[model samples]
Target: MTIRVVAKNYVKPEKVQDFLGLCKSLVEVSLKDEGCIDYGLYQELENSGVLTFLEEWKDEKSLDQHLNSSHFKEIFPLLSEYLEKETEVNVYRKTL
Candidate 1:
């Protein structure tokens, strides 16, 4: 079954633009991964420095692979520095 993930990143104020730049590359690379159905990146306009990702993957395995993928590893350290708080990720599956 497809898994849905909502990942939130609250970036530090001064690093907002830098974070966006980092995300652009991360998004570009993530989209090319196997079993990645959808990967959408967006910034919360009203709340600066807040970014969110809505993703859909083929399965838990696909999602797990993505978590460990090189793209993730490459960007995580850079992304971490800009975060104001721990990144929050919510995972789900449709029951309907």
Candidate 2:
């Protein structure tokens, strides 16, 4: 099944720029990984501090691989520090 993830993160105002840079690098690397069908990072227009990640993978295994990937490890923990709280993530699988 195709896996979809909606991830939301609220970043500190001071770290927004750094977060963006790291996100760019993370996105670039993730796109090249096996089974990465789609991935994007977007900022909310009404709330610039909020970042949402839209991602799709071939299956649960692919998503697991991505979680263990260096790209994920390198940026996410640093980004987490700047977050207002823990990241919010919603995972879904297509039924139709």
Local accuracy of candidate 2 as per-residue lDDT tens digits, 2-94: 999999999999989988988998999999889999999989999999999999999999999999998898788888888888999999998
| C-alpha lDDT of residue 45 in model 2 | 99
- Global lDDT of model 1: 0.90
After aligning candidate 2 to the native by TM-score, how far in Å is the CA of 34 from where it should be?
Answer: 0.7
TM-score on alpha carbons, each prediction: 0.92, 0.92
6-77 per-residue lDDT for model 1 (tens digits): 999998999988888888988888888889999988778799778999999999999999999988988877
Error of 2 at 55 (Å): 0.2
Query: Where does candidate 2 stray beyond 4 Å?
Result: none
Cα lDDT for residue 9, candidate 2: 94
